[model samples]
Target: MTANPARRSETSRQAILTAAFDLVGEVGYAKLSIEGIAARAGVGKQTIYRWWPSKGAVLFDAFLALMGGGPGDDAALPDTGDLAADLKTVLSATVDELNDPRFDEPMRALNTEIVHDAELAAAYAERLDLPMRELKRKRLRAAKEAGQLAADLDLDLAIDLLWGPLLNRWMQRGGPLTHEYVNALVDTALNGMRQGAPG
Candidate 1:
């Protein structure tokens, strides 16, 4: 009996992605290489190269795979009617993921690649950022329709105001990314936006 070619190829791809993700966490992205990932995955180097153009590309896909799904898959944030509580819940989960040791190094490496690689940046924006931002905006739009946010609030600006500080703080290590911290952010942003809403 012969193994299905498609199944075998999928297995190899999964192995390669898992190996890349684990190696980046253990060795850091600067020391990670296709050969090392191939060795760890027990696949040939040619197999990796055939699937991914560079180590960074492999790392990106590995990160995405570990995340379980890509954009458009789970497109909604939890909308529990109370916008503040919902944002706090989601952002708190983000803090946990960012602070996690297993995810920290690979996420940092992916951000670095997105910064320097134009093509990767475009792919990331198309596949990840845009979808996530749309989810945020969808929630915010719901709140606005409910008169919880400013009638004229620019959803994009609102998104930035809510998220930019946390992102900056995390990337700069300027402060602890605690649930309390994110709750505070959610409260502060929502308070201001609510105040700005027409009475």
Candidate 2:
């Protein structure tokens, strides 16, 4: 029986990602290093270098993996043609993610790195934020075209308005990220965007 190189490679890659994810949670991003991850993952520094350019890159990929969606999934937002329901479902999932301890601390650490390092911030936007935002924007544009939203609705501003407060509350530790709260957020955003709503 011959050993499979491809399977071995995948195993090594997953080990690296898991090590990075765990280390960021344990040591925080500022203190994490390639050498530390290599030691934890039981691989040499060359193995990590073969796959990632920097610790931030590794951490970003790991975080996305932990979020239940890798960076390459091209699926669009669920469009059952009901914008309110879709938005509520998405926001409700976000609330659950924010409330999960396994994800919350690691995400907070990565966000802190994003805040302090401009290069890392740009990479995060390029890898995750911009793609997801564009998908949501596409959905919003569809809603507008379908008459579910005002024709003049600014999709970009609408996205900010819909998600900004939730992000603030999640990141700032401001309040409980309850399912009811996310539902309210979706209703408020949609009602404001609906036709004939007061500005």
Candidate 3:
């Protein structure tokens, strides 16, 4: 019996992603390496190199897999026609995700590097942040179309307002990340956008 090429390829890819994910959580991004991942995955280093150009790329793919999405996929966010409810749901999940030590520590390590490395930050934005933001923006645009938001909402500013405080709380360690806190943030941002003049 011959092994299916597609199945073998997928199995190897999954192993690499899982190894990268667990290694990053345990040893963090700086200590994570292709050799370590290959050894852990029981695959040759050449296998990983053949698919992904760098460890960062593999790690990013792992992160995407962890989020239950693929590169540039944003289907994780639900659309229920209620902006406040939807925002609260998503933001609350984000709060919980950030609170997980496995996710938090690795993300912090990656973010630290991105902060210092402009090129890496640009790549990260292109690969991760921009797609996520565009999804959120799409939801906001839907809300505007439904008259749930002001007609002339400046979506970029609206997005910043929606996420800024949450990001601040996450980065500054100024407050606890709670469902209640995310709800408040959503309310405040939505109310502000409703009342404020369009930019």
Among the numbered candidates, top lDDT falls to 1
Per-model clash counts, in order, read: 0, 0, 0
Which lDDT values do the candidates have, in the order given? 0.89, 0.87, 0.83
As for lDDT, the candidate ahead, 2 or 3, is 2
Candidate 2 displacement at residue 99 in angstroms: 0.7
- Scored by lDDT, model 1 comes in at 0.89
> Candidate 2: deviation at residue 107, Å?
0.9
Report model 2's TM-score to 2 decimal places. Answer: 0.88
Q: RMSD for all candidates, in order, please.
A: 1.6, 2.1, 2.8
Segments of candidate 1 deviating more than 4 angstroms: 195-199
Worst 10 residues of 2 by lDDT: 66-75
Q: Write the per-residue lDDT of candidate 1 for residues 26-143, one digit (tens) a residue.
A: 9998899999999999999999999888999898888778766675566699999999989998898989999999999999999888999898888888877998899999999999
Q: Considering TM-score, which of the candidate structures 1 and 2 is the better prediction for this target?
A: 1
For residues 78-163, what per-residue lDDT tens digits would candidate 3 score against the true structure?
A: 78887899999989888988999988866776677678767667778987888888887888988888888888778999989988
- List residue ranges in candidate 3 displaced over 4 A: 71-76, 116-123, 195-199
The candidate 3 region of ten consecutive residues with least summed lDDT is 68-77
lDDT of 2 by residue, 1-199 (tens): 8999999998998899999999887887778999999999999999999989889889888977775654356668879998988988888888888797777877887787788878889988887899888888989999999998998988999999889999998888999998889889889878888987886
